[model samples]
Target: MTTIKLHNTKTRKREDFNPIDDKNVRMYVCGPTVYDRAHLGNARPVIVFDVLNRLLRHVYGEDHVTYVRNFTDVDDKINARAAESGRSIGDITAETTQWFLDDMAAVGALEPDHMPRATAYILQMVEMIEGLIAKGHAYAADEHVLFAVESYKEYGALSGRSIDDMIAGARVEVAPYKRNPMDFVLWKPSDDATPGWDSPWGRGRPGWHIECSAMADELLWKEPLRQDRLSEGAKSQPHVFDIHGGGLDLQFPHHEDEIAQSCCANGTDEMARYWLHNEMLQVEGKKMSKSLGNFFTVRDLLDQGVPGEVIRFVMLSTHYRKPMDWTEKKRDEAEKTLRKWLDLTRDLQPSDPTTFAPDQKLLDAVADDLNTHLALTYLNALTAQPQKLLDHARWLGFLGDKARQDDEKARSAYTTSMGSGASDALASLANRLDELRQTAMQSKDFSQVDAFKTALLAAGVEVRMSKTGVDLQPASNFDLAKLDALK
Candidate 1:
């Protein structure tokens, strides 16, 4: 059994992962609020978790792992969008959800096993809220049900904040009805204009935190939640899940609140045994914000002609623990590298798909806390063996069967453009650069070497030189006519 080490935010250490049930390994990652197209920052966790999901499927059989990423359809933002667009709430959510799917799929992410919507589990949310109230962990005031943060003594354990500090620094809703400033809403009354469901309190809907707790409980928990608050043997029930994850931003109030309500309602000590969070993302060394004019949706980049594979490559080049910066330079380098690899492994397929396994070192890198940057290093090493590199890259979701079909078409076009004369011209240019280097080494005043290199770049031909020789390669937009002018 290969040991998997993950940094658990709950324990604050990279501990060995021991599944509660190996036969049914489960994970739940916080998903998007479907009010708009997912931005680049939003795509980070999707890609990060998708890699984890793939790694899990490889380690544990594909049938053994169950990954659930939920959709937040019932949000104030969704409702506001509905009101502003003058469209029905259902229409807005439905359209936005499909847009999110299309954009995430474009980024080489495999869909999770479950994508639950908040609206579909209203009954479960109400049941869990009522159970929390029955356990005295929550109370209703001013037609809004609020969870009593004081009731959960380990309230700040995950976020590592003292209650006094939380009360002072937290930007909580200062409603007169709340018992404590940190007390968060479990359910809030909805007006006739807003989306609502009939509840014991009034026409209302579940709060943001409660929706996830309820959904995860119903879908991923090993056992149904213990509804009866006074059952003696209830605490021993198997309500715990394997892993819970999301962006680091959700660590404080959102995830903290989920833990409180879930433990209280289910009569368990823990909701999830392990917690993980990927760091945020940025654009060009600055925070990705709309005001900065850098915040762009995933679709926007795709529309701008950046291949989805390039985006994924640039993203995975950095570990998920560090903040990722999206830059055109990174995209260009990623595209050039992918093109080179595809050219090396073009039209190659596994002789036997059943026996084709990912390279062990590549899998080991992924298993060790999802060190994707290290996995890429291993991938670079395999470039010498095209067949092995092709097999491994496929497991990492690059140059798969479909991508190879496209690669063949592009290779044919590239071959047609670079005939015998063109190849002869490229070799001649390489020899010229090599001769220039040798002359420069002796004269120490060969301005001609720099001049020729500048001219080659102007003609859009990438040039490389070493002690032995020089190499020249063409970019996607390489101009042969410009190269002929240089010649």
Candidate 2:
């Protein structure tokens, strides 16, 4: 068995992963809050944990690993969006939830074993809140239930911050009813205009932090054992899952609060054995912001003809702990590489997944803290073994059935549309673009290159120019007359 090592945020060290039960391994990753489209930054943790999920399934038997990612359907953000858009809360949440699912699926991510909606688990959340109050870890005041942060001595252990530091660093909500400044809300009163559930305190909704804790506890800790899906050893240690993961930004208050709530409510020292957090993302070496003109969503990239495989490839190009910068140069390079790989293994049959075994070095690289960059390097070197290359690429969520079929369809379409004469014309146009680009690079003026590229794009041709040269392909709306005019 390949030993897996992960960087645990709780301990801040890379440790060997030993699941409580080898027969059944469980992982929970915080998922998106469906208020709007999932932006590029949101996709980071999705792909990062998606890779880890794939690795775990590969090492353990496919059926043995259980992955749960939650959907936060009820949140203030969703409410605000609903009010601003003049749409019902349910309508907005349903639409945005499907958008998130479609965008993630396009990025080659497998749906987890469970994707629980926060609204669906409101009863569990209320029950957990009641347990906390009974245990003297929470108090209700002003029709709002707040977790007593001082009650949990190790409240800031996961983030490695003291109570004083948390007060200073976090945007602590100072309420007249809160016992301490750092105390967070478990439940808050909601008016008739807002979405609310009937709870012990009043008609209100669960706070963001409590939603995750309750859902994770219900799905990972209790429900699995209740269903007899886990071995006896796994059930012995309740309230502790194998791994919990999210982005670094969530480390401060959200995750810290989850730890305090789950541990205090369930009488456990830890909510999860290993806490994993991926670093943030950037665009063109700068933070992605609408003000910066670089902010976009996963759907944005997909709409611009950048394939989801390319996005996943570029994301995994860097180690998860490092900040990943999305640049056009990197995007072009990734597209080129994936196209080449797809061409090489176009008609090759992959090994049966049940009996499939990846190259040892490739598996080891991934197992070593999910060094996807090194694993990609190893994948790039497997071109000689076409079968290995195809199987391994599929394992890494690339060149799968859809990708191969799409590549074949595109190639066939291009061939049928372009006779020998038009093929020569397309090649000639590519050579012309290459010459103009080289000249512009030397002269430091790109007016001619830009104009020609714009014209090609207007004619529905895909223009990809890189350091090597220019490669042009005709789209479904290709215009031979446009090419002749350029010639």
Candidate 3:
């Protein structure tokens, strides 16, 4: 087994990854706010970290990995959207969250093991706030409770900036009740329009940053006192997780604040052992924004006929930690590459079971904190050699027919234009195709078997049966260049 390494935000260095519990690996990634349609920029972290989660499960047993991603359904942004749309916040959040899940699924993002919502964890947030107040790390003033920035000595450790520097850099809001310029809200009183809950302080709502910390601790942490001793003799040992990931934009205020709240409340130096942040996706080297008219939603891209896999491949083409520039040409190139891999594996016989030697260099690149750019380069080099391309693609989870169709249309336009030699080539192609179809039939892969037969027939190949199996040959002459054009 290969050792995976990750860049830990806390230490600001690439380090070998070792899970807290060898049997159970835990991870939590911050999820969407659910105020509006998720833009392509937002999808970067979702897909990038999803791949990380997939890799972790592959490395460890599937059942051993616990990946938690939460939703901020009760935020100011959501409240504002609800007010503007003339709908209740609950309805708005619910609709947006559903849409987000659908879009993420389209892009091949795996659902997290746990999808905790902020509204569902209000009690947990209130309890954590109470604990902070009891511990003297928080103070209530004018019906608002604020976390005392001076109390947490390591507040700026993750972001690598001094408290004074952060204060100066931040556009700190001047509130009369706040003790320090850097003190942030834990809970603030809400009015008739905003959602509120009865707490020790008053009728208020949980602050945005505090929601993630409490939700993570609730879902991922197990305290002995909270365990039921009657049903279970003794509390199970705590399973410390491996990773916490999000976008780079969260590094300063969001992630930094989460670290402060969780560590200070739990009385532990380590909340999550390793923190990972993916770089943002930009358009023409500028931050994508609606105001600039450059923002693109995932649905928009899909509606434009850009395949989900192509979008995913483009996202993975760059290092997860480096900014990716989205361009039409990039997507075109991704589509072309995906088509080549699909063609390479189209006639592959399952019985052959091509054994691919793991590309050590590619594995090393990915293992070293997910250097996807280098890994992609290695994959490209392997594809340049005809024999190893299909095998290499299988390891990358991009070789199967489903993965291919996810990008290219069912029948390529190029294949339709092939006039003369295409039919002749189909005869040779049919021989190899028949072998794969028979293997699929024997394995009871009815779907693949059906698809192979249909594709061959559509491409002017005729199949006939013999005692052993099926035999196929082309119907007439067709142009190969025209087929390439369709591709």
Q: Top TM-score: which candidate number?
A: 1
Residue-wise lDDT of candidate 1 within 75-176, one digit each (tens)?
A: 999989888989999998899899999888877889999999999999999999899899899999999999999998888899899889998998888999
Model 3 CA deviation exceeding 4 Å by range = 223-240, 347-362, 382-409, 412-487
Ranking by lDDT: 2, 1, 3
Worst 10 residues of 3 by lDDT: 226-235
Question: What is candidate 2's lDDT per residue for 192-287, written digit by digit as tens?
Answer: 999999988989988999999999888887784544877778667878889999999999799999999999999988899999999999999999
TM-score of each: 0.89, 0.88, 0.79
Using TM-score as the measure, name the better of candidate 1 and candidate 2.
1
The candidate that wins on lDDT is 2
| lDDT of model 3, residue 441 | 68
| Candidate 1 residue spans exceeding 4 A from truth | 222-237, 350-354, 405-458, 462-473
- The candidates, ranked best first by TM-score, are 1, 2, 3
